[model samples]
Target: MKRIRFVLITLSMLLLAGCGLQNTPEFQPTLQDQISLYCLDHEGNLEMREESGRLQGYCVFTDGSECAEADFFNGVCKAGEIFGEASKRGEIGVLSADEAVEVEVNSGSVDADSGSDEIVLE
Candidate 1:
């Protein structure tokens, strides 16, 4: 009887621990709901834009050839080849609404250079 009780108690503890883990907030990468800001390259060129209430952001070369496209939300860029290249070249910036001033992309906070092809916004 004592052994059964011990096993049951152990199982209960494990279940509780699992429940706790499930309740704990996980690191989920979610896009911003609104376009509060847009990201640009170093040359002050627009890297991301919203079209028809959709997020449409991409990277283009001087020759006008699109290299990569990434979703931009709340100043965050996710998944694009050209975006990663631009990021590596230190040519990424974020601009807030009603402000022409460009802000540097935070390397620690931004997931812009992620090579994943997953389109988060649209």
Candidate 2:
């Protein structure tokens, strides 16, 4: 009886050991993960949530400013530089002078006081 119990215990231990030997693949970080990591390293706050069966990430700076990273819109902060509005395919692109000028011109056209507080009835 003692020998039979020893054999059973040894087999159980071997089975448990074999369970840990799974051929699981290593985790690979996605683009959103990479962006979130970059933001985290740049003194920014990270927020992650699931929406519509998809994961989304957002990064907010210390000065109450948030950056956007999405399709056709890429915003990342690296080495004290802000990169904005471009395609993000695992690469960061610098904004050019002409694009900056265009953005400035477009932004200048919007005036906070342009809208009248009182509506005029005809």
Candidate 3:
């Protein structure tokens, strides 16, 4: 009984440790992450949820881990929007720049803003 309990405890610890395992800094950019970017080239509304200057992209990982539906356009991140997390596969953005900056989303919502507001990360 003691051995079984010990094994179970060990397994639980390992699982929790694995879940918490993540790269340090969590602030640097990685290349392997999958990302999608969208830009507002023209001023037309197809009910595409047309917003201006918003970077739309996401970073996907091999293990099916990913940061999806992130937005970035210019040089500023909208409020309640985080770029990504270290624990995540990788951070991706829509309407993102050719290069992604190293940033971790500390808090906030990643939902698309109104048509009036543009999504840009500086």
Candidate 4:
């Protein structure tokens, strides 16, 4: 029964994913297409100034329900566990929102300079 529910929800999220996946902040060797790594306890924040000029806001991850909203100068990234089925069912409390965020620890940059041939998004 549990497996069936997981499969159904997985299918739903897949169908809803259109193309906004390149902005995930999980800090992996290689980024996943539509899946961002969700952290359980370790939380973080970042003030990113993208060269593309399309991300400026806050990225927060706390207890559950992480979100990322970038603007023109700096952007934010976060990840956390979610309780209910619908992702939009909760509020952004601890990870509410911030503009002056900064990246203290990042795993994504470790992947940026590595050889493209040895890179794989697992």
Q: Candidate 4 on 1-122: residue-level lDDT in tens?
A: 99999999998888778554566687545332112222212343443445346643333444434444321012223454222212232333233333343535433323557754233323
For residue 102, what is the lDDT in candidate 4? 50
Candidate of highest lDDT: 2
Query: What does candidate 1's lDDT look like per residue over 1-122, in tens digits?
Result: 99999999999999999887656686664443122223243222345667659866554434443422333332244322233344533466532233454346444333468964333432
lDDT by residue (64-85, candidate 2, tens digit) is: 5454534212443323334443
Residue 46 C-alpha lDDT in model 3: 15
- Backbone clash total for model 2 is 0
**Cα misplacement distance, residue 53 of candidate 4 (Å):** 2.6
lDDT of every model, 2 decimals:
0.45, 0.56, 0.40, 0.39
lDDT of 3 by residue, 36-103 (tens): 23222211111222234754354333333223333223323332334444212333443223444665
| TM-score for all models, in order of appearance | 0.25, 0.37, 0.21, 0.17
Sorted on lDDT, highest at the top, how do the candidates line up?
2, 1, 3, 4
Clashing pairs in 2: none
Model 3: residues with Cα > 4 Å off, grouped in runs: 23-122
Give the local distance difference test score of model 2: 0.56
Winner of 1 and 3 under lDDT: 1
Model 3, position 96, has a per-residue lDDT of: 29
After superposition, which runs of candidate 1 have C-alpha atoms over 4 Å from their true positions?
23-35, 39-122
Tell me which of candidates 1 and 2 scores higher on lDDT.
2
Model 2 worst lDDT window (10 residues): 101-110
